[model samples]
Target: MRLPVRIALLLILFFCADLCFSYVQKELRPQTALQERDIPNALHPLVKQNAELLQTAALKKGITVVITEGFRSIEEQNELYRQGRSKKGNIVTYAKGGESYHNYGLAIDFALQKKDGSLIWDMTYDGNQNGRPDWLEVVSIAKTLGFDWGGDWRNFKDYPHLQMIPG
Candidate 1:
């Protein structure tokens, strides 16, 4: 093949390879639909069902509540508890293993998002005056579905936390 012809073919082949790679990446990429893993470890079986119901209800309300964390093993619970107690940061979780409602599957952590995958999670309650407006927008929606808002806790207030009372 002539030098120019060979180079032209190479460029075309390179472009085709790139195109195929892009396509494959798009197809192989994990389906990040809802964060199923966000469900906390402490949820009770009935609470889990309540959470599922709330998830669907939130979708109908126009906010996408994604489960970002879920079920915890005793080991995971212990580690988390330890981290909270000894860590340099402020104390967080009070429940350890059997103490945590997570052991019973009664709690869940959820986030809101637009269609483009922009997460709406707040580490603290009403993080700012304008902070986590996204999270607050739907907290009530979850309550409407019968879940208690951790934000209301007189002590250990967790704005992002929600729990359901088994009906």
Candidate 2:
């Protein structure tokens, strides 16, 4: 084959491989069962459904949950990592893109709020005895809705985080 023609063919093959690589990276995870649909603001379906149900249940106990964060993009995660890598600001959260379930749209961070919308985030998970029990009932509601609460993580209980197992 002529050198020029061979080079052109090789360039085409390289471009196709690059495109395929990008696609794979974008879809590395299995299909998002509940994330791709059902959420009010682009939430994963299962996550949103269960979250709403849990929110409803919490209402019965006079607890209101405010979804503080949800569905972070890789770029957002990267930015967050930079901001949180330090111990300052009480270390709000610790997650990096592809490391956090949020990348798959299966996670959300929530906080209990009062009638006036003041955050009531329980600080007891970190041994702060002054925290309130407002979010405990929210946990019960989430369990009934089939969500795995990050609050139950043994090593690091995230009192304000809720997650999905995704059937």
Best candidate, TM-score: 2
lDDT of 1 by residue, 69-150 (tens): 6566667777787874676656668767655545556667777666677776654434224445647657766787777787
What is the C-alpha local distance difference test score of each model? 0.66, 0.69
Q: Given candidate 2, what's the lDDT at residue 149? A: 82
Model 2: per-residue Cα lDDT over 1-167, one tens digit each: 99999999999999999999988865654344434544333567888787777777877666777888878777777677777465344555566655666766788888877666677676433221235455666676777887778877767777777777567
Cα error, candidate 2, residue 138 (Å): 0.6
Q: In model 2, where do residues sit more than 4 Å from their true spots?
A: 1-41, 86-90, 123-132
